[model samples]
Target: MSQQAALLHRSTHAIPKTAVGGQGCYIFLEDGQKFLDSTGGAAVCCLGHGNKNVQQAMIAQINQLSYCHTAFFGTQASEDLARFLVDSTGGKMTKVFVISSGSEAIEAALKLSRQYFLELPTPQPQRTRFIGRTPSFHGVTLGALAAGGHILRREAFRPLLTKKTSHVSACFAYRGKKDGESDADYVARLAAELDAEFQLVGPDTVCAFIAEPVVGAALGCVPAVPGYFRAMKAVCERYGALFILDEVMSGMGRCGTLHAWEQEDVVPDIQTIGKGLGGGYAPIAAVLINERVVKVLDAGTGVFRHGQTYQGHPVSCAAALAVQKTIRDENLLENVRRMGEYLEAQLRAKLASHPHVGDIRGKGLFWGIEFVKDKSTKEPFDAKLGIASLIQDTALKPEYSISLYAGTGTVEGVRGDHVILAPPYIVTQEEIDIIVNTTVRVVTDVFNSIH
Candidate 1:
């Protein structure tokens, strides 16, 4: 049978069908099934599949220089990509450290944050701990995992993870906002909680406050309230701590802006971005250091004490450069905004009235639909129900032929159900309609069967 399965799959007993081909938001299975990629493969395929420009760029780079270590020589592809990213930020971010994945980028950010404090004239090595939000996701590596607040993902590794990082409540309105609390009051309350945590941890001991501008995965596409980011940044500033934003799943025009923090009127000292950076064309992520931090480092050590073998892979950089250029050349950000409004309207019109649908919230092209057992009570379905997982499985059925991003533990990282929809920026009205119809049908069928 040609070795039915030798690979260790995510689930020990279940092996997914092999995908042989994909193009422009659709994946082809070996069994002649075509599935619509509504979640854009975890929101990474921003430019969709089979992009000729990105492919050509990668090929060209390979023909010239495939790989070069940062410790030795810098390639043209890497330099150009860095310059493009810095210019995109209007020089707000002065330097870039290209890495292999989002986790690595976050790791770099954390280390750089610590190093920045040390590089200052009045060094405070006591600033060693980090503060992140509960029900947030940073990355999967130990340091990054420790910084994240995902209960389920961190459960097994809790004993091994560092305890230096602490967490506070996220600025999630659907569940976090009380019945009578106004937006200003909610922001104040959250800010108070953060300030209290800093005091509890000893303000000088905290290094930075890290969070996703738009919470993804752990709390599924939840955005902050109007004045939330400003308040959080203020708290960080008061403690003399760096403000780090993890835009891995929300940056690179995924949220209708080049940077998710742009809409909030808050600038981060250090930022990490991935997913859409290379748009699934190659593995690439980066850490963007603001001028303030770069200046301190340049005056002191003049070197970041970190190194990776493939720190700035030329071919990967070329692929990402090409992908980013395409997003700009095609004016996809405008399409993201226009199509985002249309998609949200369609979703609300179709599913907002469903008895189980509790919340439909997001910005730009990123949206999350959270399901509940009782709408009036805002009570989430039991974890044992695996409601979100069921919907995702049903979405991929041959009859439906759709892919969804499912997340669990939305409420305090223990009990909640939600699915995210982040289609490619190039998605059209027809594709949006198909996605909406399929999602509505899938959610309805899953709940109907359970009921």
Candidate 2:
């Protein structure tokens, strides 16, 4: 970042280039730099940067009824959007608690799950503990921060978080898979670890097992192995616990399906989703609840205990409705699948042979390329080297001026490095080739300097 950018109000020392305009798969910087939006603004913007239908929907909603507090009344936009999501989800998910941001939606889900237990005929007062993975991200808010497992993010706020949650092993194959372990064996090991955590916590005391179906920031788009969710779900059910999938980064057609778990062949009792839900046209997220939990709340309290000022904001719902509709109507998910395969193939063909490249893995339009110092032994570059950070910084100079996502501490708490690519769903094969070609050049350039 330049001195002027550093002086601005953004929190991080690394200032982001301003996005001026976008159409289709391109994002134009304030200085008129056009780059393929691979990360979808941190896995947001599913319909791409500037979708015409979503924008028109937002405009229409504003003209009709922009903002209406739900305390007094509800709008047709909110009601229709709710029905749309519920129906699309196959009607098994009975309720949607909308909020302004992903973190807010997570907060609401946590509170709602806790309150649902309280409303039960046999109240589970002991169900105060939340079980989460070791290297996962839920959100950035204090409560959501507590539920997350990013040590660097949680370091400062450890004292502020409630001592109500416990950490477990994440189902990451690259780092967590044991020596010579089969996929089933690895999943069994992870499930055992979770079962042991339940035993340690006294199963009855736990509330939900929270995890990202495909991890986003912490592990750089790491998807759990097959049968991983099923095994984990069994453990949760054995303990009479709830399974909560944080699809905030993977759901809503980002992975070429409506839900990431659909590919996993399991269902979450409570699911949290955002980013792509409203396509960045308006800030929106949702906590999707199954019928079992809703029945408890319906029979006992008859009203939810939580509230948000912007819950179910009509304009946000309208924008999301249009975004979802366009995806279905235009068959954009097909494009996501086709382009995603091309992106993966190109990444593999280009960087699979690179010396510093350790692993490249992802699905659909979401992908990650991990880097290391020694490929034979998979030893990471020293953190002081800041390989990932350097790559992030170097890509933004006057020469390249491209935007990419970088991550660190991929192995343990403070080792390993990788970069993520989550292009928009509407990306074309031609544009994907450009993204792949530029990425190869960028990685080659960054590693050349470091080595």
Candidate 3:
């Protein structure tokens, strides 16, 4: 085995079989097992696998000019990609900063938010803290890790993590809502918690409030209760803190819209996107800044002060441009909405009333199933049970052939379990049925065996 195999086998427990090939909506193992990739490989493959256009785009770019440093020359592909991103936002987003991964996009957003405040006079020198929500996931990068709230993921690195970040309760209505609270009241309470956090830290002393429009990884695709984002955005505005939305997993076409915030009706000052942005064709991510945020930099600093040699590389940009155009030209977002409704119906009809299923929630093709010890009580499994961990494994059985993205500590940072299933936008009705049937069977079997 190569060092890659050894490292994954030893360091990452419960690693899956080798994915020798992937096409359309499935990944093939070296042993000839074809796993239905309902999770779209972490919701990355919006264009499905083995997209010919994206491949050709990459090949042609590499053949022409593979590796030109951004320091010396700018690429047409990067410029075109920027135009596409900005235009996708209806000109609301004026500028696009390219980066390598979701984490890098987040790192850039964090830096940009801080720099936004720096452009302000005196800029409230004490405004160094960042506000995030419990059970939120930003990224693994240092700045992103500091902003994230998963207790287990942030434990060992606490010393190295930034100390100024604080967390508020997430608007997870399934678990966090009061017994008899209305949606309006629940959103109010969460907003109050955020307001209190800002006050506690002195609003002017905070840099930005970061959150995923739809909670990914940590909370299993939980969208905020109605009015949650509006309230949250109001609070941030009141405090003079920029609202940063991490739509890395939920944005692009995953949520049936170009921007996840579009559904919420409130745009962020700085938005981070990745995963489906390039449809997993190449490593690419970006930070989309609104005109207001960019104006501060242009007027005050005259520069963003952030750049990487590969920041706007030609090949990555070309791959992403092709992916975005393919999505738009193919009219896949409509399919996302239609198929999303079907998937939701199947999940609800098949699994919602199951004894251990706590919640089934998502938007567009991105969806999640939360498991619990008792659905009636909304109590979570003990972390040691590893409900999420085992589901991802059992679903990949030789006869079954499925891949599920498992997440734990969804309730807080160490007590709940859920598995996310975001299939490719190109998925057919037959494939959707296969995924639903396989997942429901595996999930039901897991709980029955455990109970």
Candidate 4:
């Protein structure tokens, strides 16, 4: 039997290489091969592997207090982390709920939004519905899954998902925008569609309108057109519904901003952040509650009716606190903005002429390259071919030795392929060249082999 025989991996038949250690932007396998971590493992490793600051912080917290049940007592680590997050928002967000992962943060946001309605001076018991954008991913947990509109991820759990959630068009300009349509017109049309959905579902019954400022996995790193989010927030405000932003994959300086919504010119009532929050140093995510919702709850319940066994794990909080501090102190966001421009320029310069390269879109260090069978038509390759998977598999080979985050169903929830490139914020320009060159080679190899 193999070493992994006792383990249950995501794929039953395939066992992945064993990673012995990681340093900076590279991972070392047991077999002595090294692979450059290009996508940060689903965009999680902002500070990259074996970061000394986060490691020491985790070790220090472990020595002081490893865990603390939130119900019994709160630890200094959690309090400090929460304070840092709130202060990061310039006091726009007043409260923070720390959790274990992005999915849990989203679940907490969902329940909190629901409870916010009940805690209002005049309870909106009927406000139980949630509105999300199609081709968007919030998380994999049931509550987050229900609020998400990724068809493939939800198909198996259809019977288990909540029926109270509805979806509208995602702010994906590459696929959704019509020919010759101005950005303003596209934003207006999407806003109208959201308004119609609210009217269709009875606006009074809605609890929140949740969306990612930059759509990650489901649609790759697709950002909204200017004024799109402002318009959507307006609709939610007009209907008295809470606005939530799921920044799980694109927040925490991933987009050259502390919060992705900072670029969108809107402050969400509740925002979910993870991935980059802890920078893969510890399992942690958080929900930031705005003053508007905090006041309502403070006036009424003075408590959020939710609890998790590991809601604020001290070690996790300590590591995350260190990660945030490192980002701020090292001026990494500035690097993200500077390096992001270079990465985009290099990608476009090299791959723009590739017939199979459909679109290259993103902000900061988060980017995605969608593949197509017909460049002029923007027709995605047949899903069965698994273009994204092929690129990912080929990129991991010893010859190439680089890791890329790949996604299918980019066109919708069933028929497109794209790979994301989210290098660590600490990445240098030389490393960016390696990533770009390796990516071009891997992509070219895959397509050439296919033909």
Candidate 5:
């Protein structure tokens, strides 16, 4: 084995293999093994890998102007990308702040939400608390972490996390809905729960209600029931609090639409997007400000009292602009819809009846297969079993030659296991078949061995 490097990774017990190269949806390791990248490295690589156009765009920007402080100058790359994003939303979102990663974007969103209250005409100094959905995964930064509801992730850092953020039950129909309860009833119940929380916390004391339009890793691709988002948004509006949607994993065409909230029939006061923004070519994320929020800042302070050195980075913006242009010019959103339908059909047909396969959910190119110990009761295995982690490891073996994103704590923040598959937008029918067949084989083998 090679000597351990000086870098600190997520785990100190294990070091991952070195990825030497990648093309399309497959990554090549240094040892010459190839593996299909199903989850896009946590749903980030929308354009797959090695796209010449995005590369050239980034390289050209680096040649012309690589780095510049956002305070000093505004590059064409940032301005053009921001304009494209605004146009994409039909001016619903009037301003954009490009940052390096999803975590940073989320941090900016939280801070901006707080700042928005402070800059209001009346100045709501008491609006300091935030409300988010349970089992949500927003980001890792302190403010973002406080707003997130992943118990396992927040457990160790609980002492340092602010108590200002509170969580309501997520719109998880699989386990949350009762057998006799209708969708409308369940949504009303959840909405009432949110309202009661606001009342308990003092409605006027809340700054915003934040949630992912479609829940991601923490809950394993669970989209809300019909009218769920609208109800939540109404609650926020009733309380005069902002509605913030964290689309870090489900945005940028990953959910068939450019924005997942498009399907929900609701507009957010603030939105954070990453993962698919730069398609993993460069580290980038963004916060899109609604015109209402922009208006308050425009009228009051006339300046957002926040600054980051790498905000609106030129090269990252160039790469992201090219990525967005490719999605539009190539009409990839249409492909996402088509492939999403095909992928859903294949998954249900192949694994829906499997005993361990409790649920299959997601939209567009992003999907998740949740595992259970008992399908009849929907009982999750114990956390110590590490089923999700095992699937991830076994899928990367030489024989399998597949890579999947795995998650635990799907049922709240402690139990349940799931594996997510988020293939690239350019994937084809043949590749889809391979992905499904390999997934079936891998899951079957893993369980077969255990039995």
Candidate 6:
């Protein structure tokens, strides 16, 4: 019997190759094959695998203290990580709630947003609803899942998800914007739609408006157009609803900014960050609260009614702090911007004119290529063909030895397909060339096979 027989994998029919080790930009399988990690394992390994700094930090923390329940004791690791995150925001975000994953961070943000309203001097107990955007992915946990609009991920749990959440059209320009609509007009239209949704749901009854700064997974790496987030935040402000930004896949230097919102000209009332936080060295994520929300809670409850056994794991915090410091010390964000431009140019120069490639968009080291059945019409391929998955599988073959992140339901809830290429912050021009070249070959081969 296979050693993996007892383990339940994502797919039961096929056992995935065991990843025995990784370093820098490549992962080595048990069979000794090395594959370039273009997608950062869902865009998490910002510093890439096996960083000595992060590993040593985790080891040091473990030796000092590995487990300290937040309720009983506080560790220096957690406090330092929190301070570093708040300082990184330039004190715009006053407090940080360290957690174990992006899902937990989001769940905490949702609960905190609701609690903030209740703790307000006016005390809006009516604010029980949350408004999110369609084709957006927050997380998989119940609260986070309900707060998102990833139809396929939410399908099985539709009956269990909260009915209080409603969705508006995503700020996806490729398929969302009208042919002749100006950027200002497109922003206005989306803002108006959000306002209408708030009104329909009773603006006063909404707790917050949640969305990713850049749409990940469900819609691939789709960033909002200029002035898009500012307009949405304005609507949320008008309705007295907190604005929540989930930067799990786009922030922490993924988009050439430590915080993705910095580029959007807006600040979130509450923000959830993960993925690159620990650089895959350990599990860590955080919920950042602005002064407005922090002040309210301080004046009223003085306690956030949430707890997790691993709420502020010392080893995780240490790992994340080291990752952040590495990014700062090495000035990787600058590299991300420079290499990101090179990547975008290479991808467009090579694949933009392909018959099946429809749109290429993203920021920093993150990018997505949408495949279409009819380029002129922007029609998506049939869902059953699984173009994104096919491209991923093709890219991972021995000849290619590259990994790409795939996504479906780019058009509405279930049609369009896209694949994301989010390389590590340490990625170079040479690495970018390899990634793009492999992507071109894999995409070309996949489409040709189907044809």
For all candidates, the clash counts are: 0, 2, 1, 0, 0, 0
**Candidate 3 TM-score, C-alpha based:** 0.97
Weakest 10 consecutive residues, lDDT, candidate 5?
1-10
lDDT of 5: 0.93
Q: Which pairs clash inside model 1?
A: none
Steric clash pairs (candidate 5): none
Q: Residue 143 deviation, candidate 6, in Å?
A: 1.2
Q: Which residue pairs overlap in candidate 4's backbone?
A: none
User: How far is each candidate from the true structure, as Cα RMSD in Å?
Assistant: 0.9, 1.8, 1.6, 0.9, 0.8, 0.9
lDDT to native, each model: 0.94, 0.85, 0.90, 0.94, 0.93, 0.93
**Residue 184's C-alpha lDDT in candidate 5?**
97
Where model 6 places Cα greater than 4 Å from the true spot, the runs are: 1-4
> Where is model 2 poorest over a 10-residue stretch in terms of lDDT?
1-10
lDDT per residue as tens, model 2, 1-101: 45566365646555666778888767787887876676777778788876778889899999998887899998999888889888878987888888888
lDDT of 4 by residue, 90-173 (tens): 999999999999999999999999999999888999999999989989889999999999998999999999899999999999
